[model samples]
Target chain A: MTTSDTSVLAPLADVDPADLARLHAGLEAAADRAGQLDIAYTTFDSPVGPLLLAATETGLLRVAYEIEGHDRVLETISARISPRILRAPKRLEGAMRELDEYFAGRRTTFDVPLDLGLSAGFRQLVQRQLAHIAYGHTQSYGQVAAAVGNPKAVRAVGTACARNPLPVVLPCHRVLKADGSLGGYAGGPATKAILLELESAA
Target chain B: MKTGKPPFEGVVAEHSATVLRVCRAVLGVDEADDAWSETFLAAMRAYPDLPADANLQAWLVTIAHRKAIDVTRARQRRALPVENVPEVATTVPAPGDQDDELWHALKALPDKQRHAVAYHHLGGLAYNEVAEILGGTTDAARRAAADGMKALRTSLMGSKGATR
Candidate 1:
């Protein structure tokens, strides 16, 4: 019950919060507002097509192929992860730059941190193993399955590759059919062929 | 009462306007974004530590008050290219003349009173909380805010008539 030092203050004038909201949205969309939105995403155009990169505070979340559709991809991830999503390009700068280098044939492996919350269980296990398949390298789906301690789960490995949340970043394109033929790819076989050719040419 | 922790985005949605009003009052509209950004950045970094029952608005405004001081100090050390900057380079639209007059008046008040008024009225903190931020007994903060209000009433009217 001590005496306080301030005088009675007048009510401040009403300000339009809409301006602040819009400003927040604008910042969250671009350079200023970083690490605030729960899920921040950006789109990058590569030789394959428009690639959608989404991230969480943990790290890079998803790298969606064009065939999956960026809007649909983002909507699905936002629902699964957190709904407070925004197009924060600043947060995706590292991924974009790395993708650029990869596409330019100057880089062999991805070095950015990844948020692998999209996949789990045996699929997650397979994805981690897939990441180690270096540039210009291809392993048969059965080979990848054996690497994950389930040599008989050849079809499971194929399923995992098809459902990869991060295709290009995790290098899931390196997995193919047992007969050395191009298997199914989430980004379409044509895109897979492009990636395989790029790696081989590199 | 739900004991669940609402997301940090919810905090931003709930309190951004109050924080903006506090910053605009203390730093004026031109530099308010600087304070706003710094405040939220700091808050987000420390959000995990915030108590579930904490007064979210007051906590944010306190961070904002500290950030405003930092901006002022940084501005002091930097060279003043402010006056010579071209209009086209500025992104934020200037406030309308009427709003501009109020800003001019608020900026004219003494720093402590302006801060006191902002923290108490705009930021919606109690006098005791304002005192903690302003570094005084609650009574002193009350006096400063009252004095600031008296000055604003005089200037808001005087400046309005004179600007015509």
Candidate 2:
């Protein structure tokens, strides 16, 4: 809707672009001061594609692939977590750096803390086990299921990896299909292959 | 409660401009940004508790109304000394700024009329909702907005004709 309700006020309806920017920055700072910003996120270009990284005070919350739709991912975060989210890159600085290093083949492991609040129960259990798969190591879904102490829950393990909130950081891409073929990835098969290839080369 | 609230960031992105317009209309530019920031900060704080299906714009305008009053109260508390008062007691926005003539005309309207116009017309609230926010009957809010618009046109036309 137009800012002006009447023709007379329409002329004055234009909010100065500079003022809007300045005011938003001020709001972000104020929200942070008030402890109202629940999530801070940033997007960085990666070898596979752009990745959306989000964090809470606890630690890194999510890592979304470009194919997953950044806006949709943020909306899901808002729904599941708190909606007081902002695109504050500073909160994700460490995670972003580690990701860059990993993609560049200079790093093998992530040291950043993970929130792991998005997944729960068996899914959370499976996600937690994924990190131990190591940087360049691969595990079949059946293998991962058994590792989590549920040999018959192979399909469930696949679901957990597919729904992984922190994919690359948690190393869900390392979980492959039973036949050693690429399994379904939250970041899509092509991205899964890219991550796997990047790791295998290193 | 509908149980699904979108991100507060979306709320800010969608409605910040309108809220700023309402604030600028109510408090002028110098204080509008402050009011806008305060309103969103407050909104973000209270967002989780808000009903998922509530009318967001009207809710935000209501908050902006409160914040604007706070600003006005602060301004009054910081009143200048008699000798320090300017010859023209108007808040004239910078020259060559967007909508200078219109802002001057808007600045001339009475407080109730200005708020009625801003909340209903600029903020896109219904007259009844504006009435609820303004604490008056719906008809009164409608009349106030109509009068405010008329005054704006008269003042703007007079100034425009004089300049031409």
Candidate 3:
């Protein structure tokens, strides 16, 4: 971005491809060294903006929509998980393929290993319950609360769904309001609508 | 203490290009790639323990300097010329090609001077940092770099005049 850089590098600008290839080779080596890595992640563009996907040794941990600020999410992951994270797309290849299939209406359920590290206890319980809501099916927040053995925790169920770390995988978008209307979504209202329409049409 | 930072991927994305540039400047086009690969691999291995307040670029350049030294020593030990990988062929190794001339001039300097110019001007390290890299006093580093630049300019101008 600086003129100083261009002046200094004037001779080398033409020699790009060879250096880039070497960089990739080195990065591949780094990627292969997974022992020091606590998390590996990548971004996949979806029908609804870019989805920032992160994973741990255990499994896929975080699925953040563009609305959640991908940079901020990565910082949180570094703070909460081990800071030894890298952008290794090979780790997220399966999740991306599955997401592609789901968006194309060729698949309903995600099969990638879920980390569930971000959500736990009652919230995690609610996430698991949400996953059972079946593709193209809708469940009221009250119904989800009752299923999780906290019938009086209608608001809690809504909170759990909104904070669902892995949205598309957990099918949290399938959770509707008690009056059968599309409820709030962490990924934004328009994205929730698009997901609902995608599912219903399938 | 909350020492929050972007993912390691962000770090790589942010600085890999600059590191490559520095490597190429220090090592020249033919051997720069190998030095660059080693430099980044080493950086990534040690990235987790790097202090939050560390100057990431400077740290990377330091690693690059060490890697360059290792690579140069290895090349000297080798008896055979390197097999040229297929490069994007540019016709006419033309004169006034400032880029090519710069590398030629850089490689022509004395070892200490070459390193001084590279670690200071190209790698953007301070005199003290360059001194640390070169294992010399700060004054020595500054003098070597200045002398190196004079030699580089003379060689470059000579090349330009010959072609004209």
What DockQ do you compute for every candidate structure? 0.14, 0.58, 0.46
For residues A13-127, could you state the per-residue lDDT of candidate 2 as single tens digits? 7777787777777887788777777998889899878999999988999999898899999888888888889877877889989998998999998999999888899999999
What TM-score would each prediction reach against the true structure?
0.54, 0.89, 0.85
Ranking by lDDT: 2, 3, 1
Highest TM-score against the true fold, candidate: 2
Model 3, span A45-133: residue lDDT tens: 99998999998877899999998998888888887776667777777889999999999999999999999988779999999998888
Fill in the DockQ of model 2: 0.58
Off by over 4 Å in 3: A1-9, A13-18, B80-101, B159-164
Model 2 scores a C-alpha lDDT of 0.86
Residue B103 displacement in candidate 1 (angstroms): 1.9
Between prediction 1 and prediction 2, which has the larger DockQ? 2
| lDDT (Cα, 0-100) at B150 in candidate 2 | 78
State the fnat of model 1.
0.12
**Local accuracy of candidate 1 as per-residue lDDT tens digits, A1-202:** 3343322223345667777766676547432345447787878999999998888878899988877977677667745675456566778999999999999999998988998998999999999999889889999999998898899999999998888888998888999898999989999999999999999998
True contacts kept of 2: 0.75
Which ten residues in a row are the worst by lDDT in model 1 chain B?
B1-10
Candidate 2 Cα misplacement greater than 4 A, ranges:
A1-5, B80-84, B87-98, B159-164
Model 3 lDDT tens row, B1-164: 34675567777767777777777778776777788777777777787678888988889889988888899899766724655633324323466676676776676678888888777776778888889888879999989988887676666665456321
Interface RMSD measured for model 1: 6.7
